[model samples]
Target: MKTTRTAEGRVRAVIYVRISQDRSGAHLGVDRQREDCEALAERNGWEVVETYVDNDMSAYSGKPRKDYRRMLADLEDGTATVVIAWHTDRLHRSPTELEEYIDISERRGVTTHTCQAGPIDLATPSGRMVARMLGAVARHECEHKAERVARARLQKAKAGEWGGGIRPFGWGVPTGETATKFDKATGEEVEVPVLDLDKAVPEEAEALRVGADIILTDQSIHRWVRWLADKGFTSTQGNPIGHQAARDLLMRPRNAGIAVYRGEEIGKGSWEVVLDEPTFRAVVAILSDPSRRTTPGPEPKWFGSMIYRCGLDGCTETMICSRSGGANHPSYRCQTRHGGGRRGDKLDEYIEDLIIERLSRPDAHDLLLPGPGDVNVAALQAESEQIRRRLTDLAGLFGSGQITMAQFTEGSDMARAQLEGVNKQLGRAAVKDPLVPLVGAPDVRVAWKAMPLDQRRAVLRALMTVTVRPARRGRMPDGGYFDYETIEIGWKRSAQR
Candidate 1:
């Protein structure tokens, strides 16, 4: 066994430093931490191998940084025997990350030292106990800070006070010590005196004009943001507002002269209201309306749109759903007259209805509602496992000089393609399950009536594999003979009743 003195002299160390945000004096913390870590390393006769510094990065979540994860990998691979930091909390606030480091220390024979907390020999039981206790304290501190900040926001919101952040579009921040308001409609300055808590309307209006209000309501802010964007207004950051950001702003109540923070109301005594009650209510109404809100360009027509195509040869024309002359009766018409070689024969509404009825029969249930059973699931899982194993084997072969680079690359590509195909099939199977029972149900007509256009299309695609040529007559059935002999109808399970 090696003596303690020899082991101590041979210890290799790495230093890690991190600061959450770039404050005016952020460099001071980084420099101080480095200095402390180096001093501890030198005092223990440990040879410092490398230094990893993460500036302006949070240790709370153990996310948003590549260097931090890389450090863990290095430790796991035995690249570093010891880690030195200013404090354990500086290394990690997340319990999971802390646990990972503890595991690495135990399995890889690594030790951690903090300038403030001294040596933590993770190989020993006492050291692990200390590390766990410290990790818990750090996690508590992070959570406590989050709770405190949340509480502060709630208090500020309840008072209808501006929480001292970026001003929204359609409003200007008050400059200096004096309060002033700008007219959004006229782009002119207006002298509006600040008011006490008694006068809510004027105060709120002033807040709105100055962009000092926090929206606090169920009303969506997307409509308002889009409206502002359409009017050539931008956010306080000089960036166009996104849908989600706009929604977040509108949902906050503080902008509407009411304050709510952390699920509680804490009205601000000094903050003035930005918008009048009537105007706020109107904005809310406009945002909540399904028709007025612009997303995906309207809900689209429920049926009778140009979404269907005739698949018959020589008659491969698109179908248009239209209402009969002077009537609300819907019908499907081929685009090309006499295109299908069957002259004067057109597909009528009745035939389409009959096809839908037939497809919805109980006998077609298996074709419509095929889901992944145990066999299919097991096959997919086994294929996935095989792909993973092949990749691993190829990597090993390459590493051991048993396979050429070209061969490895080719094998890897094939494995990846197979894996992708299996994944896609698995996804399709998931969607296929619902379609089977739906298409076979006897009451498919009712189902068709209730389903939206997109869902109807999905069912149509799953059931109909071939389009049947229709006997078409070009001119109206009651009129002179016209072009086109046949029309085509695709037979598939009907999702609609």
Candidate 2:
């Protein structure tokens, strides 16, 4: 039979130490544990690979530490063969975690040894059983301690005793006195002993109260956090209270005198409630009302307020929507005939009707409609591609520090303009008849209703471009109200194309 070597080349080990609180003066167990582990490693010819210390973190919840998890990962990856700790309890105070650790040790061939408990050989059935039993006892102790603490807190709360936790917003513990101190400014209780009203300046106290109100009413906890940071408020540990702390402070109901601790009120006698019961009820009612909620309004009309010049010469004024009649019968009058110009001719709604009738004809439709041949897809694609390339290049230049801020901005603007032009061209090519089709489409009404004011301007720009010049009366072949003449209507499309 081959004998297993008692000592390998060199045992690599990691040391993990922890303390739940800064009670170093009361208990030097952690220090002593560390010393013992170090001595053990030296005597066994083992190298201390790394030391992971998790101070002030209770292992009751089996909450894994960042450093502890990293050490585990390293062990699995062959970084360390052994783990050294004060005892099994130091590694984990929970049975579930200890069982997991034992399984990992057995599978990964990693050894766990404690300063007081000696080696935990998980590969052997007897050793594994002992470890599991120890883990159970530790977990039971932790659970029992937690239950006792919780019962004590509940009893204190029922008796209206100040169960130790966070301090209330406005009340503070009295200085050199047994009672709590009340904030004169907001009349709220400050529960923290160090944050007494006498210690805080009048202005600072006022600001804190105001910031707390803003946080509660506006639900802007971030603003309150910023205010606390600026004022140099910190936790009991002398570290700044994080964003979560500010949120908790604002949400605590004990400051408002409504918090039920066990069966009694804790800080009721110390602080005044900012939001009383009646006011809170009113706010809830308003928030729950459906009628108070806001929704988006209707879209604006493109030519709702703009003036449109008529094509008939001698018209005193341009065509306008009728105030009394419906939009369909709205007529354009020659300004001169109406009273200002030469030969005045009134262009009734018949002109618009005639234009619509002509557009419906197959011959006219073919002439106006955009066919496949009319669209230059390749040219449009090239223009879009160029714009995209320019945008990318400008972004690259900005990233590489090759272009100044102003230069990058200018390049971006130009590229955007080019891209917009290409998009307009493509849009126009897709339409059968730019002006008429848009006006006649059934969806135009919906589009008009859905569009905003800015989008309305874009629509107007797409339909018409130039001012329609009125036709002269004598220039018409027949100088009568009923005269036949071909109308020349000029309009502008978007310059983007």
Candidate 3:
């Protein structure tokens, strides 16, 4: 192949620049690297033919580096006689990548020049050894740096300090200033921000509290997203909130003043709490419950649909809402096509009245059963952690061929079943009781009416089991309607009728 050159026979050069992170998207780091590489090229009398950049990309991460690949293609086609970089480490942190680069350099008879490491001549054995050694040292430094950063983050979590990231939703924004403070444990000066933790942003904090209530009350996350949009609340990226974002906001452990590392709760956070611990845990349980409806299907339009039972002899199947006779004739029918169907409007009205009357009594609070407040949360969390560790170790053993397939399957199934139970317990504990608001209300009917249909259904399922029995055999008058006597309501709790 022919090597490209300029007037005066100067070697054609291509500069490659990269930075691991460009949080501001400003390319400032890559700009500095390019300037240094250009100076090196000028000093060597090499004509700069092209420049390639991979901004906010890490060579060690195994992610594709588009511009880097393009530059390699340019080199293979003999577009440039030499490649310039700020440093060898900037060019590669993986030994495999370095080896590939060396192979291309050898085939193309191209050489590498760095501003920091000087020239690396791939044509000579001694030069190749030096390049390999440099690559090894760079790889070691990257791995060691990763270990240090992980440890630092864990330490910060244990100390209840805010580790650096995007500003949390409710937290105050950083002013981009740093101050030095002497660390008591390390006995060294550490740079911290002058203004870091203050009271949470009032409006955002309020929004979080409202969100927690929405989840606790069994309202849809779709509702929460609409609420967030209505309040003009955007994410840290200033984008409108979506369903997942809305759920994430409610699920954040920090809202309950809890410190977490790698998704595990470490301790309390050194910040203001927007939600009480019990309430926060309950909301999490409700959202994470495996049985919770996530995929879209037919949503219940009536309170008794899919919940009330058919009290017909030998047919006690659950009932479902049907509009077979048209919208005006919507009714609840037994799932097994049992003898008769009940009008949806009449059944819903009777159930609503029964619930309000039961909750309106002076002793209504007694009907509320034991809630998540009685759960041993710490013990459950510990057991969950242990099961996870066991699962990880089991996988490792299986991967190494230390255990038979049968043994692995048995162990995994047993451990998973136990984990499932533990998760369900935790979820139950975290879910808030729907009856909390309606019970002991000054205006019970008014408060019940204010609740959404789903929450009202929750209260119904919690308080009583309704069964629609077959209509009594008798000749009815022309204008006669639904008989409340045919509906049997059994109280779930032991309370005075």
Candidate 4:
């Protein structure tokens, strides 16, 4: 944030240049400020023996400015008789900093100059008063500007527009570059991200396409990431995409054309949609609640990604597989006495045999297809309810005279507009479960058998839900043995479609 130079002279001076913001990343404001400061020193016949700068650093933050301190030290050491800056505000925005600087300048008898605010004599009361007033005004301006920027960004978010961070995956600028404008206030060039519509990131969009395919599962999503990396795909920062990152890219609502703010889906994004809502929701369900909710690890290959909960009659606990009967006999057992060890092969083969039989049916394919209608009516209904609540709140504000009629009308219109859009979308939504295609296929048995563990779990979700229970213990003629009953199956009625 600083630059320095050394020169020799008896009447030596140090120039302190500071800029609060450098949006262009070019440091142009600092450059111009330095130029003006140098010209001021030459006109006054002051020899600039050194230069100190604090670029893109705010004095109002109360953090020590390194060059500002170094310049002060140079003054105390008798290295420079006068200090110059683009303005006193550039030197400080804090009234406290001005007061402290006044003591130092007065004791050390140092003269300070600005290209715009003219010279300041800290030794006198009037000069000190002027500095204090300027400091207060500058601080006020800084705070007001910050508030305005924050409000602007919030409005953008509310409108479902892009606000911060790099362009999201599966989105890019159609124009291939952002527009630029000269900011008169800072005299610097700034790129405007809002000017151009970001379409899709091409290679990344293809990855989203692969994600939308019913064939791709969370297990396959990682392979896709590696495959894309091989195709030269990288993040906006040019870093290799990791496993979880790829899952988020495919499953996050933002990638599916929805705009989320603070963990809530606010509305549709202005960017082009990559995956349809049904496909996106399907991916989310598979990635969020399936057997392999996290990255694939050392789960036994025999488990087949099915999440089994302990379903012993009268026992309400989830089942976890563990080694039983010494080191080798594995079982899916319930903690309750009503539950007994269900042999791994017995249970696994039973479920697979069930799926193979169910998929082989003539009308079962229809069940695999997503049911027609709004995908998530609960979320949409909640949103609509919130809008009504907002309108009620706005009316209350108006009645209490807290807001003008114009303000109330504006707020009401915004809420109603959002409600209308949400209602329209809600009326139009039809859910297509992700696993519908696989099970609905003529060769569903082959497809089910060929599916990866994660994909197979998705199928389990689309067609039927399974629960296991321990059967009554059976006693042999010579001894006793443990046994489990057939699992309870709850098939969704939609599969009949």
Candidate 5:
């Protein structure tokens, strides 16, 4: 190869190298390209001023290549009169990028050379045409490779195999005997992972199960966050599990042995189930409720803050917890300020005692619905599974070129809409009656105490409506105002004995 010299007497060159994937984190591919490029530069007597290498960076992914950008900057600054690479495809897999490179090279009077495809004079039309052609071929190969990879992944997902990523919590991949397969490329047998089945990580699985129960009972996700932190458990990234993380952890479909692809539930996975489907659905619904508060706010310290009603004349608004004028204790006052406040702690105690006494009755079991009422949980689950399978099949048809994109899109939209409706029904059905644990417990008081504030509040709201009537008389002997008579607990029709 003959190298052209600059007016200053020496030909300045820059070598650009890039490799798409480097699973070993070793730059062997780029290193080989760099070695070849250096040898070509040496043979041509071109002065190698810089070497730009973008390791594990794909030209087709449209991600920014830092070293490539730097090399371009150097070329623009007149630091190099020549650009060398292993091949024209190594320089660009995109036609638009090739055009830009051609424009820059033309303006800078810089020529490009490849160890394989030889020299490309950006200053001439023929050379630019050849570069564009090579770029187009590279783009075709990239798209083909992407299609093959997508199809392979979809097939794997359909087969209920692990799609491969960071291992999910509550599951462990065991070290088992490796299976060997004949490799056509190397003409030798290679050891492959037997079958990526994940077994239950006992402790993590138990934690997830407990989390599901807590979330299903309307407990705040913060409690689970605290539980995780106390248990010394962190996320796969080793970060302390926060409220959102806990919520997401409990909401994973994988916990229920359900596989998901691209945010859509596909079918059963190949992992051990950590949580039941109904419980998982219920927890997901609770955590994803739009009306649920996600902002930072104090948890309810009293059970009746929002459940108790302001029973003043013409003002039956819900009461809220409030502290008045440096009072040592907070009170439940009308949200609209229509009536006087009732001591929150006293009201909570009064309500809790009433609940314990009522649920302690022999007929407390009547409060629960007889076998899920009209929900048909099993049918809903089956229907949701069918819809998910339909969507997966539609995707397969589209990927395999059996259906046009338009047809696939329309079918998928309809199936997804159906799935959404069914999932919402599943979510609604997932709200197990909060009264189940308390109503039939051996000791209702102990069970009530063991229950979290949210669960207690849910039971209160469901069983009865407590109305805080106007205080009969102001201050009592202890300098506090709370009369049992002023607290009216009206049991709902569902709670009627």
Candidate 6:
């Protein structure tokens, strides 16, 4: 390409390059842009002053680009008389930014040049009009590209194709036997990277198991993060996981081999589930519940004990865990109105015994309704599977050119909407009572004591209600005393056959 030299002087030129994705992995795109812009500067007899690069940041993303901002600052300071880029769009994909550039160029007497699109003569009316039109086109192309990418990702999600840099916990990247390949062009042997999951990370899987089984004792996400850290576990990025990130991982349906898209679980996924459906669902419930984040105080000594309120008329206060007779005696005491307290150990034992008897019945399952929705989980699963198969078939037909893009798009959208609706329904479906098995175990007492406080609390709450009253005055056994009327237990009337 022929070009004229700078008639004024050897003007200093600044070249800027940016790339959103580097498919070549060697940053060849930016390198090529720099080389071409250098050649353009050489042709104009301009001094190559500096080069600015903003890698992996899209010009249209609206995210602040450090290098791009620095270049603009340099321009404002009158450090550069000429700006060089591979193309106009390489510098900007937004028309507003293009306007800013135009204003800056006219004000600073800076000439903008592209290695490919030639010089942008801002002084003339025709040049400005052409520049504006090119900027408009670039902006239009960017919007369309974004729309296309979003649609493609949605389609990929529907197909249950995992797409992310960080791997989900409890999952292992597979390794395979490497095959030697002789590259004919390069005359070198290369080992192919394994693409299958034949290996498992035992430590990662174990960490997930420990977390899933933990009772909802610590409501804070930080508790789990600290726990995982103590276990010497970190995220795929090899950094300590944050509270929000840990919660996100624990709540994902993908851990249960359930397909999810855009914050909704579609159905069973293609990958093997690390956790069973019930346990996974339980984790999600505990983490997602807004009430799980109570006021940041001390952890509860007894789960569900706070539910006990003062039964005395006109003096209502939720009982709290407190210590009695030194550290040896922990009790639930009502701080409001001083309604007295009950020994935590004794209260828990009585409740557990009551629960054991209630659940040991022949018709114990008739008590609580699963959930309000009462959705048939099996039928939902089947219907979702059918929809997935239909989608696959429709995609195949489109790929073979048997169906138009419009037809395929319409069909896919309809199927996805249905799948999402069903997923919402499934999420509300009541899971089997986890405590029921323990209740029906060989030894109810052993099972009750062995259970986590949260699990025991769940059973105690479902079967009966406990009312804790103040101890009788002047009654003592070993520095503390509680009358028989202090603890009152009642079975729910609705629970009766």
In what order do the candidates fall by lDDT, top score first? 3, 5, 6, 4, 1, 2
Assess each prediction's global lDDT (C-alpha) against the native: 0.59, 0.55, 0.83, 0.70, 0.81, 0.70
Q: Which digits, one per residue and each the tens of the lDDT, describe model 3 over residues 318-426?
A: 8998888456878888988857677888889888988888888889988876776678888987787688668767867998999999999999889889977886677
lDDT of 6 by residue, 1-497 (tens): 11122346667889999887764345668998899999887887888777999876788977888998898888888787788999998988887778888887787777789977988876567778889998889989989998898777767666666655455666655575676655545666678654333223677766665666553332345556667988888887688886777877877777777665566555565666676654565577766667665444555668546766666554557677777656687777776737556777777665666677776776666664465356677787688778877887887899899999999999999998997676555555634454555644777667767865555656655566667666678756656555656566667737751
Candidate 4 lDDT trough over 10 residues, lowest sum: 1-10
TM per prediction: 0.47, 0.42, 0.75, 0.63, 0.83, 0.71
Give residue 307's error in model 1 in angstroms.
Answer: 18
Off by over 4 Å in 2: 1-8, 21-32, 177-252, 261-497
What digit string (tens of lDDT, one per residue) describes model 4 on residues 388-455? 66876787799899999999989998988897677555534533354655655667667777766655
Model 5 has an lDDT value of: 0.81
Instruction: For model 3, give the 10-residue run with minimal summed lDDT.
Output: 472-481
Relative to the true structure, candidate 4 reaches a TM of: 0.63
Query: Which scores better on lDDT, 2 or 4?
Result: 4
lDDT of 6 at 212: 67
**What residue pairs are clashing in model 3?**
281-430, 282-430, 282-431
Extract clashing residue pairs from model 5: none
How far off is model 6, as Cα RMSD?
Answer: 7.3
Q: Model 6, which residues run further than 4 Å from truth?
A: 1-9, 22-28, 170-193, 197-234, 239-247, 255-269, 273-298, 303-305, 312-317, 323-328, 335-346, 349-376, 383-430, 476-480, 493-497
Could you give the C-alpha RMSD of every candidate to the true structure, in order shown?
Answer: 20.9, 26.1, 7.5, 7.8, 5.6, 7.3
Model 6 lDDT vs. the true structure? 0.70
Report the Cα lDDT for residue 464, model 2: 40
Q: What RMSD value applies to candidate 4? A: 7.8
